[model samples]
Target: MILDTMKRRRSVRRYTGEAIPGDVTEEILKAGLLAPSSRNLKPCYFYVVNDRQLLAQLAAAKKAGGAFLKDASMAIVVCADETKADTWTEDCSIALTYMDLAAAERGIGSCWVQIHLRKDADGNDAEANVRRILHLGDTMRIAGILSLGMTDAYPAPHEESETDRIIRL
Candidate 1:
């Protein structure tokens, strides 16, 4: 069943502009929180944004590949307290991935918008811009944003042949 969900999962950018139900959204967020972290520190934090104006601002957080976020019904900004965990990046990534998968499993479309180590349209640090926009403290290091919504755009699933390299150790 998990594999089936994985096969169904794809990076969805277009949405039908239909809002996800409160319960479904909560389920997705809960899945993210269930992700594992190194030393069980659980440093990752999830910021849910549904405000259209805020979503538009976040859409510009990166120089490219994030414009679609403006149309998403909602977005979950994944970040972590760098001071709390050296593995913040990996932890946050796992959380975001879980959330993405959960959305797909629930018939919702999702897209991962990378922010860490990225630059904004004005060439400023994308992470910094997001932190400022969300009023997050300097210690919060953003991993990415997960844009979610209802959509009819169902891309094909990943084929085994798509794996370019898989060396047996």
Candidate 2:
């Protein structure tokens, strides 16, 4: 079942403008919280945003990407506190994957918007702009943003051949 969900999951960039239910959003967040982390150091924090204005700003935050976020019913900004773990990036990455899978399982379409190391239109850092908008202090480092909404279309299934990178003993 987990494999099935993973196979069906894809980056969904378009939505039908259907509003996601509160309980469903809560479940997705819960899944992120339950993700395994390095040395049990759970440093992930999700900041859920539904404000249209904020979403629009987020869409523009990256000049070349995230324009789709303006149409997302909700966007979850995954961040981590550096003080909480040395492997904060790894921890938040796991949480993001878990949340994506959870959303796919629920039939909600989602896409990831990468923020780290990206730049905005004015040559400002993407993470800094997002932090400013969210009122997050310097301690919090953003991992990515997950844009969510009802499925306008299901993406094509994954082909199995990409296992080329796997190494097993």
Candidate 3:
């Protein structure tokens, strides 16, 4: 059933601009919070943003992507506390993935925008800019951003891939 949900998920860019109910949003955040982390150090912290101005700033945080974030009903800004875990990136990534799959299961659309090690159009660090806008401390590093809303478009599910990458022992 999880694979079926994964199969049906798409990187939905377009959104219907409908607000996800507070309860549903909480459920999605819970999914992220429930993710397993290295050494049981749950390093992930999510900032559920729904402000229009902040969304626009995030949309432009990265030069090549995130344009759809402005229309997203809410964007979950996923960050990690490095001091909490040496493997913060890997830990936070799993949490973000769980949130994405959970959104799809509820018929909500979502997209993940990579921010770490990226730059904005003006050449400043993307992660730093987002931190400034959100007032996050230097100790907190971003894993990614997840835009969530009602679906405006549903891209087709991916076709089965050729079995060339698997290496069985």
Candidate 4:
């Protein structure tokens, strides 16, 4: 059953624009928080963005192929404080994976959005944009984002990985 849920989890790029229920959102976040972290530091933090206007702005800033954020009901910006956990990126990634699987299990669709938090070549602070958009404090750093909504298209089945990719010592 769990494997089925994992297999069904896909990077949904299109959404139906129907807002996810608040209770379901809470459960997804709880699942993310329950993920294991290095030394149990659990330093990941989440910023839930449900504002349509804000989502649009984020979509515009995204350089990736997917435009789902523009029409999705919400986006969860996962962050971490490096001082609390040096392996914050890895921890946040695991949490996001858990959230994705949990969303699929509940019939919700989600896609991961990678973000760069450092200053750009023009000296523009990337973190400043995220902080202003999410009303986050200076201590927090953006790790990644997750666009959430109802699916408008079903994902194709994944192909099997090659056995040669795995090696036993």
Model 3 over residues 134-169: C-alpha lDDT tens digits? 999998999899999898677889887967778888
Ranking by lDDT: 1, 2, 3, 4
Best by lDDT: 1
**Stretches > 4 Å off in candidate 1:** none
lDDT score at residue 98, model 1, on the 0-100 scale = 93
Q: What is the C-alpha lDDT of each candidate?
A: 0.94, 0.91, 0.91, 0.81
Model 2 scores worst on lDDT over the 10 consecutive residues at: 57-66
124 Cα displacement, candidate 3 (Å): 0.9
By lDDT, the better pick of 1 and 3 is 1
TM-score of every prediction relative to native: 0.97, 0.94, 0.96, 0.87
Please give the lDDT score for candidate 2.
0.91
Once model 2 is optimally superposed onto the true structure by TM-score, how far is the C-alpha of residue 96 displaced, in angstroms? 0.6
TM for candidate 2 is 0.94
**What digit string (tens of lDDT, one per residue) describes model 2 on residues 7-113?**
89998988999899899999999999999999887888999999999999898887677999999999999999999998988888889999999999999999889
**Stretch of 10 with least lDDT, candidate 1:** 160-169
Give RMSD (Å) of candidate 4 vs. truth. 2.4
* Candidate 1 residue-wise lDDT, 31-107, digit = tens: 99999999999999999999999999999999999999999999999999999999999999999999999998998
The superposed Cα distance between candidate 2 and the true structure at residue 129, in angstroms, equals 0.4
